[model samples]
Structures are given as C-alpha cells and as structure tokens.
Target: MTHATGYAALSAESPMAPFTFERRALRADDVRLDIRYCGVCHFDLHQARDDWHNSVCPCVPGHEIIGTVTEVGPDVTRFQIGDLAAIGCMVDSCMACPECVRGPEQYCVKRSTPTYNGKDRMDGSPTYGGYSDHIVAREQFVLKLPEGLDPERAAPLLCAGITTWSPLRHWKVGPGSRVAVAGLGGLGHMGVKLAVGLGAEVTVVTTSPAKSADALALGAH
Candidate 1:
C-alpha cells in the first residue's frame, strides 16, 4: 500500500481537512496514476457536507482528475508507463452488466462505481477522490488524454464534457436541431459547446445576464 495526501472530512457536517490515506496495492488489472490536477465539482461540495446524508468520512472529494500513468497492471494494454491518463466520476462498473458491455458505463445497471467517496468493489474501503497525489482504478474507467488539452482545464471534461455529449448524441442533434442550454456553468457550458459544434443551433439560456457575453463568445448565438 502506498500513502496518499488529500483533503477530506471526518464527518458529514465538517469542512475538509488535510488527511492521508493508503492506496490499495495495484491489482493486475489496475493502473496507477500520480494525480497532478483535480477539478472542484459541485458534487464534491455536496458530498463533503453530506448534503445527501450518505456521507461516510473521511470523505475525500474529487473525481475530475489528470495525471501521469506511473504504473500499469500486467494485464493492461490500452495504457503504457507514461500516458497522460485521466479518471472521471466513475471508477468501476459491474462488467457483467449490460451497460458495461456496451461501453455506456455511466449507465451501468449494477450502479457504476464512482471515482471518489464511493466504496471499493472488492475491498469495501471507501473510495477517496482525486484531491490527492495518487489513485488506482480499473482501466475501463481511465480515459486517454488527447494532445494539447491542459491538465488543469482538461480535468473537468472527464465529467462535464461526457455528461453533455451523451444527450446530444442520444438525441441526434445534427443540423437544424434547436438546442437551448439552461445554464452556463460547468456542465451547461459544455452542453452548449458540444451541441453547437455538432451543427445544432445552440442558444445558451442563462438568467445571469452578465455572463451572456461570455456564452456568446464561446460560440453560442
């Protein structure tokens, strides 16, 4: 086991505190990453305060992560020793589940394992998140970083980008589709960009009139 440095809460109502924990030993199917950057998602704030009452501490809060692959399991093939790999809001899925087999893991029928503040499938240990120095996860949940994507800015894409991508893709928002994104923060911004890029007429619907210019600058009309 290797020790990791992270920010976590000791209980549901607590603010995050500096903490340390051990990374599980690498499994033959696992890839180890030296986490360099992690994005702060609203979910992290919610879970840290136990907004859902499911908070189990010490809750390490993060999922959007960017890092270098320092080690790979003997059985891993898609990644090598120095790949720029990423982990999103997911860590594992029940392989036997239908969605897992189909690659839409966000819909894993057995409930896809979350990246952090989740329970490990095998050890039952609480899965701490990426506000840390290292993480180990199944290769299925690891995404390869495309070139020129900044590690810091790119972290959020692992979650925000795909969440928006799915809906546009599912609805087939091609030419002539009218897409209106309700919010411009995080997920919503990604939604607008993806929809517009896919040839839809993207309208960023925002109550914050101040951000209107920013949205339009991002290619929304």
Candidate 2:
C-alpha cells in the first residue's frame, strides 16, 4: 500500500479536511500517475454530501483528472514514465458486458467502477479519486492527454467536454442541426461550445439575460 493525503469529507455535513489514507500497490497492467489537476464535478459534491446515499466515509471526491505518468507496472505497455494521461469518471468496468461491448464504458452493465466512492472489482478496496496527489488505475481506463492542449484548461474537458460531446455525437448533430443549451454553467457552456463546433446552430437558454454575452462568446447562436 502507498500512503496518500487529500481533503475529504468525514461525514455528509462535514467540511472537507486533510485526510490520510493508503492506496493499493500497483498491479500488472497498471499505470500510476502523479495528479496535476483534478476538476470539480457536480457529482463530486453530491457524493461528498452523500446526496445519493451511497458515499463511503472520509470520501475524497474528484473525477475530471489530469496527470503525468510516473510509473507503470511490469505488464503495462500503452504508457511509460513522463507521459501525460487522464482518467475520467471510471476506473474499471467489466469489458465483456453488453454496454461495454457496444460502446460507453460508463454504462457497463455490471456498473463501471467509478473513480471515487466505489469499490474495486478485484480486492473490493474503496476507490479513491484524484483529489489526492496520485492515483493508480488500469492502463485500459487511462486516456492519453493530447499534445498542444492547455493542461489546466483541459482538465475540465475530461468530464465537461465528453459529457456534452457524447450526447451530441450520439444524436448526430451536424451543420443543419438546431441545438438549445439550457443554463450557462459548466456543463451548459461546454454544451454550447461542442454543439457549435459540430456546426449546429446553438441557442443558449439561460435564466439571466446577462449571460447572453458569455453564451455568444462561447460560440452559441
């Protein structure tokens, strides 16, 4: 086990505080990364507050993670030391399942192993997230961070970018498509950017008209 430190919520109502825990030793086919940035997802707050009633105590919440590979287990081949990588909402999944075979490991029939607040498939250890300084995950779940992208700005893309892109892509939004994004917050702003990038005429519907300028700046119609 490896010692790790991060801020965690000891209970549903407790504010996050410095907490110490242990991470499992690397296994074959594993990649260990030194976390550079971890995006704050809405779900992180939900879990930290036990909103869904499934949170584990001393919960460390973060999923939109960006990092550089520091070590690789013997059998790992897709990455090596010094490579930039990322892990989204999932750490593992049963690849043979229907949801995984078709596409979207996030919908794995057996339930994808979440980056945090979930149990490891093998040893059943509580999965800790990227709120810590480091994380270890199977090579399959770790994605390569593309070159030329700003690592800081790109951190949110792991979650926000994909969350919007997937739906638009699945629906086949294109040049003539009409898209309307509600709200101008994190996810909604990304929705506008992606929809417009795909050539859709995007309309951002927000409660405050003051956000109109920001929406247009993000490329919404």
* Alpha-carbon RMSD of each model: 1.3, 1.1
**Per-residue alpha-carbon lDDT of model 2 for 1-221, expressed as tens digits?**
78999889999999999989999899998899899999998989999999999999889999999999998999998998999999998899998998899877888989999999999999999998989999999899999988898888888888898989989999999999999998999899999988998999999988999999999899987
lDDT of 1 by residue, 194-215 (tens): 8889998888888899989989
Top model number, TM-score: 2
**What's each prediction's TM-score?**
0.95, 0.96
Give the TM-score comparing model 2 with the true structure, all chains together: 0.96
Candidate 2, RMSD to the unseen true structure: 1.1
Give the worst 10-residue stretch by lDDT in candidate 2: 149-158
Candidate 1 local lDDT, residue 56 = 83
Model 2 clashing residue pairs (backbone): none
Indicate which candidate wins on lDDT.
2
Q: Which portions of model 2 miss their true places by more than 4 Å?
A: none
